[model samples]
Target chain A: MLYREAGQFKTSYAADQAIFPLAQDRIGMAIILAVAFIAIPAVANEYWLQTIMIPFLILSLAALGLNVLTGYAGQLSLGTGGFMAVGAFAAYKFATAFPEMNIIVVFLISGLISAAVGIVFGVPSLRIKGFYLAVATLAAQFFLLWLLVKYPWFYNYDPSGVISAPPIDIFGFAIDTAVSKYMLTLIIVSVLALATKNLVRSHIGRGWMAIRDMDIAAEIIGFRPLTTKLSAFAVSSFLVGVAGAMYAFLYLGSVEAAAFDITTSFNILFMVIVGGLGSVLGSFIGAAFILTLPIFLDNFPRMLGFEISVETVTHLQFMIFGALIIFFLIVEPHGLARLWTITKEKLRAWPFPY
Target chain B: MAFFLEVLTGGLLTGVLYSLVALGFVLIFKASGVFNFAQGAMVLFAALFFVGFIDLGVPVVLSAILTIAVMILLAYLIERLVLSHLVNQEAISLFMATIGISYFLDGFGQTIWGSDIRRLDIGLPQDAFVFGASVLGDDIFVNELDVVAAVVAGALVAVLAVFFSKTKIGRALRAVADDHQAAMSVGIPLRSIWMIVWAVAGIVGLVAGIMWGAKLGVQFSLSLVALKALPVLILGGFTSVPGAIVGGLMIGAGEKLAEVYLGPVIGGAIEDWFAYMLAMIFLLFRPQGLFGEKIIERI
Candidate 1:
């Protein structure tokens, strides 16, 4: 009854076509915004902020990036870790080389670098499709990973091969605290996620979906395969790159190249697949579900009083995780996005069997 | 020159082992367009499952038989559970689903078998006989196992070729691979065919796991070894078994040579990328692969 939309008729095109056409969604979003921005910060402890919240936010950002390309445009990438590494290394270089520049600017610049690299690598997608495209991206995965590992200059010739974040600040605010980092990430992720949602609704986004749904049909409909596909590659990499910057800056605080291995790529890809391909909110939900599960599984034995080892719990988590993915695919191959649609549809058809 | 010969032999041996895993991938891809990222993971699972069964005191032959049975069941389960729903989905979703399946399998293998690295010695003759500095050792001083693996793979491919050519079920599978709807219309059991293909792929993975286990022991690396096959597909094409075998040998030799001759020049780590680099170069130049049919996109 509360979800009823019968009385929400619009009087103008601007109002009719506006995002969140439903009045309930607007309020629901505002409440969610209030909690994420206002209420949660006041109550949540530091540990929650540091581990779960920060990592999920950063990964969701990365998934959103992948979603734009893989989900919207229908190109497959197996080298997200490679691109993320580029962003991380570029951001590291920028932060250290020009220490005076704002860290946010460094993030944007890193994304630009990744976009450039992404386009270079993405050029092959014009000719390749499906599994072939995935293989081509692996070239980027190995080559970029090798560059990060081999070249000493990228890591400032650090003997340890790990880079550390120099205390990030914004105009003298001293944003080192987990709370501040969480807030910063939340703000950036929200804005970008919103922009992405909007972008998907726009012409380019439609073009991407057109190409994704059917390339030949899209071509006949006057879409330029080259520019559309390449731009998807570029924009998608940019979003993923910025997420990489955040991941480097906020999550690990300091890490090695192994942090962005193929497994990491697969992990994010899994999140996108599970959360809902092509849905922005699904990215956040998927990231949260995948990332937070291990912790829950790890704590389960303790709760049961069996006193299981973390390693054993981890192993069980892996097995169950596999079963879960198959379960989700079997149950809902469209990911969580389908769940959302189902929910809305149910709401629409409430109290009637017709 | 002796070193070159040694490298060639070693590389060819490695290629033979890799061909086993690629065999699983190519078989599934040919039958079903879904690129089984889980092939490597499946190899790891097979290796572990075999070792686990043997270590638990099952007779070697019995363990192998039991493992084959389990694989058949696993194949049917995956087809019924995961793949039936994904029959006509986009490639990306299916690919990611397989990745999920890989993660699940990795976790599943680790969980059931425990995470410790278990040695999988299925009693394949390990004693080596040396002919001067050149060694023709054991079931594996590179020569014996190489011949065995190559021959086994060849036999398997020949059997499959004949099966697809001679058998009604095989013909049905080929029809489905050619066009799913038409085959379905002609009353082919697409579900059962998928299950059979997956089961065969699983069995191929079992053979591969054994060979690789003899060399490296059962470890997580078996899954990563699936990396070699991506290039094989790029070299031979996804749809061709002979292409897969030939491509596997080429990459195995190429990666080994790169590791030996090109490693130091590129700071000593070419194996990870040599195959992929080769694939990318081929993709740029040929895109269709040597044995692969030309991919013509309907404009």
Candidate 2:
């Protein structure tokens, strides 16, 4: 009865087109936001805030970026790690060059740089489609990492070639503590996530979805494939880049180019696929599922009163992760988000048969 | 001049091995339109199993036979469990599934055989054969293993070519690759065709593993050869056997030449990304690849 939207009525076009038209959805979203913004930070421990939630938010943002291109636009990329590396190094360079600038500006600038690089790599998508295009993206993956590693200029000629994020200060508040970092990440991700939700509902998102569903048909309907595909790449990489920057500045603190390798690309792709391809919420769900899985594997054995060796745990983790990917794909190829929507639909129709 | 010849010869031999790995990819892709990302993992698993069997004191011939049997069984299991459910799924889904298979194989292979690198001795001669000593006033060295590999690859290709052209099962495979629905309507079994194709791919992976394992030791990095072979696959064309051969040679030769000639300007590690860069550049101009059939899109 509480979840029902029986009396909700659209009084105007604006109301009908509102992102969350239902009173129940708006209330649910507000509760979720309040919990994330207030309750979690207040009660959660340092380890939980730093390791679990921060990475989840940052990776969710990256997966969101990827979801735009792969899920919404129907373009496949294995170069996410490379694009993320661009973001991290670009942010690092921007911060060091202009130490007096605000950290948020630095993140945005880095995201723009990532967008430019993404467009260059994305040019091949027009000519190639599917697995072939996917392989082309691997060029970006290898070449970008190689460039960052080889050129010391990107890392300011650091002897070890590893760049550490300078302390982020926004408006005289240093983002050094776990709570501060978590809060910053939370704010950035929420804003981006909200913006993405809006953007995907707009014309640009429709164009991407059009291309994804059928490029030829979309083109016949007057949508330019080139611009649509390029914009998807640019926007997707921009978000991925911001996440990469946050991953370095907020999460890892210090990272080498090798950290963003092919495996990292695959990990992000897994989050996108397992989360749910086209859905915005799927990104967060996927990231949460992937990030928490290891923690679950680690603690579950301990909780069950059996001590496991690290190596055995590692082996089992891979096997289980692999099996889960296949199982999820077979069971629900649309991803975890589909299941969530299905449940929501069932709940909405509870106590009455359609 | 002698140095150039040595590098060229060495690259050509390396290309032969890359082609062997790419052959597995082509076979699977041709038959099922799946990219088969797990080809690398299969190479590693096969090598590890062979080495494990050897360590268990099995004779070389028996170990080889047993590994082939295991690979055939793997093909069956993959078809029944993974590919069957995914018959009409999109290419991307199949690609992701293969990646899943890769992960499972990586973990399972290491768990069963231990993660340590083991020396694989197939009694192949490792001595360098000196050439052009009298003609060019300098010696050019060629590893005997490379020469043996080239000969073996040539023989294998010849056998495959004949088998594909002359045999009933091979004809069935080509028919399946042509059109699954048409072939099914004409009384061909799609499942068995997939099994046969996967089995052939498995045997190719075995040969690649043995050669690479003997050269580089049977270890985790052996799987990386699969990734390295990807550029070769793109350069050659996914469906063409001749494409794999020529593409592999070009990449191997081009990478080696670039490392030696162009490495100085870039600080000397161009070998890692050279093939991919070449593939990327080539793809922009001819997306279909050197030998891949032109891609015709439909509404």
Candidate 3:
């Protein structure tokens, strides 16, 4: 079988502990990366790159960030959009304030700033849990958005209150085209996804899993709740913030504070939930599904020769989305990621039932 | 001072309306341990159905009856379709499911009724109730509709309070709230209790929908009122009905006062985040909320 690992053997601890220990997994990842970095860019149109691919990559990164906290650390946060706004605004400020700086560094600094803000909001999680903590995160979501809009300084006092991404001139080479933007997002997302995969597997990730499974037991086992929880928030926010920066600069090119509203937060949460709460690969799958669903719905009716109104389609989209969430939860509570895992497991045992 | 009183009174009245929404949330959470995030959507759906029926030239009374029946049916469907399957799941899972329900209801309601704003008029007086005109040489006005809302909310609370204490089914609901297994052992059917509680919550949603719809006009934004009720829930305790009323009043008055007194100092529109911030601060001291049962976690 193409997916079999029968001949593959780990010779050492490093090989055993590898993220993609199986030869098949490594090959699959290589194919995926190659497709993302090469094949898609070569064949895809501007609209696919700009409208679909860019947002998909950026939101996948955000969903990954959220997965670190809510999925791994057991802290349910609704402040993703807030943290993302912080990143976007911070990136805007850093980019404009230091025009000569590299864009990647600008995004990193913005993420750091978002992490700090995330920590401040995450403080309440030390005391509150569950839906109560979720509500507390909404304070961050609303207040941060409010701050961005209320103070024009965040937008550089633009009368329109929308911030436009400055041109990306890296070493005097302009990276402005959709392919270049998609490439930038793709590279960053790939690297971060790799980092997140490792981070979640490390001892810190074990600490997060411990806290998530049972905070009291985790605490009793010498995991510091404060540091573990706050670190998760910090790391999660950093990733989300970076995504927000990319979203503003690469995907949308111009953004307002309203762009990162509660709805945005919920969508990211949905991505995490529907994808697989605790899986790194699930983040991408979930993001892709959530992003592509509306487009699929819009075109499906046309393909079927049904002339549905856009308004009705939009309503149907919501109904289907909701129904799907419930359906997914009931049928496979672990999400699409779990389904993928099951498929792979079945493939490993295919043609022989023991 | 007169203006301050007007704002305070107005906020308290508005708070009563918030309590009405929060009450539905309390009913579901207490009975079934499911935080029904769809409560707001239920309100919107009920109001939309009522208004939609009326727009079709159904008499107001008939429309109200039909909407009530629809809400009860909705409760049954939600219980059978959603809650029953999700029984014994983690609280967060149930919460997420309710959010899904919220989305479905929002879309379903809008799809059927059309998403445009519809005016809901059930002959409630909309004139301003004037007071202290001669005493202060200036009239202090309270909207008559708000007064009706407060009275209606108060009466509903009283009825619920008595129903919970005196009725046989209500005691079963309380038992189920306490322990699902124990309640089932006591010959109380968990599913029926859940269905009944959801039905009751649905009726509460109808009342909230009617009042809020009449005031704000039946629209999609009516669903956002659920967000406002969240701070009230945080302040009052998720499980306590009386706590909802008190919490709603506090949040209603606190946000209004802050918006009025502090709006000039800071730019305007402080109402949006003020209640949440207040609730957040309150949560630091009492994570269980003012009236919520103490949370005791076991390792």
Candidate 4:
């Protein structure tokens, strides 16, 4: 019933151009914000906030970052987790070295660093496409991970070969509590998601779509392939970097090289493919759906009162996960985002054959 | 000099093992364009299943039969369930599907066996033959198992060569690989050909798995081993049978030799990136791969 946009038509061009053009969509989004900011902190327990939701959100952001490049821009990247590692390590170093810089600033700077790396890697995409390009991106993943492992300076020469974030304070408010950390992440993710939504609707985003549609035609039409692709790399990496910082600071707290391995890259890639390739909101839904399903399934065997080993659970999870991906690709190859859109459409026309 | 010889010999042994695994990937890619990233995982699973069956008191001959049966079943499953559905999808979609399969197989293998690395003693002799002043034990040797592995890999490659040239099923598979629609119109059962190819690929994986599991133990290590095959595919064309064998050996031996000789000079364990680095060089010059068919660029 609330899905109806009838009789609430936009009067101005600006109103029509707004992202949530429908009045109900705006209100619905506001309600979601209220629940997330107000109700979630009140209801969610510490472990839920710290372990599951926060990590999911940060990963959602990273997946979103990757989806823009791979899904929207038609570049396949298997190096997101590596870029995230760079962000995490960069944030760790920034915080540790300065000890005076604000944590928020540290986070922003990590994204900038990742953006630079993204541009460097994006150089290859101007030359390669499809499988060859993916292999090149895979090279980046291995190379970056190797660097993080070997270059002692990245870890500040810590013999542990891992980096840990010290407790951070945002605006003199200590973000040590699970609630506070969750709030911080929620705020930043909201702002970035909003920004990404706006960015994708803008002229530059159009340029990206143009390139995705046909790079040669885009070039003939005067879209600079180099600049457009590089900027995509930059923007995409920056967001991914911020996500990594959060992953290190909020979720993992301390991580070894294993956290950002090739599998992690694949996880982010799967999230995008499974979530709904080019859609921003689909990234979050995909992350939530994919990330939560296994845990839910892992618990299902036990919750239903079956005594299953964790290893078995892990195995079953993989099989189910694999099947789900294939199933999704088969049923709605566009991803969970497309599925959501269809659902919303159905909801809008509920009880009406039209 | 002795150490060099020993390293070289060891490298060749490992190289042969890698070629065996890479051969499966090459074969699948040849028959169908799908790169079986799950080859190593298939190896691990097959090996695990073989040993697990034997541990259950299945006779040696029966265990081997059951394992091959399992692989053949797996091949049919992929064809019926995954590939046929993805026949019209893009390369990236197919690649993504394979990634999903890889994860599923790895997880499935671990769950069944409970993640413990099972010791596989297939009643094969564990004695070593010595070369020169240094002794190379049979367990690690170019001994009975390794010799068997080498001969088996070579024979399969040869058999595939003959099968492709002489057999109807082989021709059907080739026809489908060349153009699915064309093959279908001519009455070649596309689905059956895919099943045959995947089944054959699965058997190839089983052979490789037995050797690798014997060496590494049947654990999650299969996925990592599979990663090595990517570089092999890069060196040999994706569709080349002999190319896979040759490429796998070059990588296997090349990585080991590099690690042994060049490790101390430039940190260590160059094996991780050696194949990739080599693959990248090949990609730059011969993007279709060493034995890959020629490409015509079009919009």
Q: Write the per-residue lDDT of candidate 1 for residues B146-204, one digit (tens) a residue.
A: 65667777887888789889998788888988988898898988899999999989999
What is the per-residue lDDT of model 1 for residues A1-354, given as tens digits with 9 covering 90 to 100? 667688899999989887899998999999999999988789899999998999999999999999898888988888999999989889999999999899889999999999999999999888777778888898888889988999898989999777787789999888898899999999999998989899999999999999999898898999999989999999989998998888988899974678899878888888888988888888888899889887887777788889777777777777778777777876888898789889987887787737
- Which digits, one per residue and each the tens of the lDDT, describe model 3 over residues A291-335? 998889889989999998889998998899899889988887787
Which pairs, if any, clash in model 1?
A: A318-B107, A319-B107, A319-B108, A322-B104, B128-B137, B128-B138, B129-B137
Q: Which regions in candidate 4 have their CA more than 4 angstroms from the true location?
A: A1-11, A348-350, B1-9, B123-148
What are the TM-scores, per candidate, against the unseen true structure?
A: 0.94, 0.98, 0.98, 0.92
Q: Per-residue lDDT for A1-354 in model 2, tens only?
A: 567678888889999999998888899999999999999999999999998999999999999999999999999999999999999999999999999999999999999999999999999999888877888899999999989998889888889766677888999998899999999999999999999999999999999999999999999998999999999999999999999999999999985787789998999899999899999999999999988987898888889998877877777777778888888888888889999899888888886848
lDDT of 2 by residue, B265-295 (tens): 8887878889998998898898888999888
Ranking the candidates on TM-score from highest down gives 3, 2, 1, 4
All candidates: DockQ: 0.62, 0.71, 0.78, 0.47
Model 2 stretches astray by more than 4 angstroms: A1-5, B132-135
Q: By the lDDT metric, which is better: model 1 or model 2?
A: 2
Residue A82 lDDT (model 3): 94
Model 1: CA > 4 A from native: A349-354, B123-144
i-RMS for every candidate (Å) is 2.0, 1.1, 1.0, 2.0
lDDT measured at residue A232 in model 1 versus the true structure, 0 to 100: 96
Sorted by DockQ, highest first, which candidate order results? 3, 2, 1, 4
Residue pair clashes in candidate 3: none
Better of 1 and 3 by DockQ: 3
Q: On residues B147-240, what C-alpha lDDT tens digit does candidate 3 reach at each position?
A: 9999999999999999999999989999999999999997999998899999999999999999999999999999999999999998999999
* Candidate 3 global CA lDDT score: 0.92
lDDT for model 1, please.
0.85
Q: Model 4, B92-159: lDDT tens per residue?
A: 67877887787788888777777887877876544555555344522223455665667777787888
> What docking class should model 2 receive?
medium
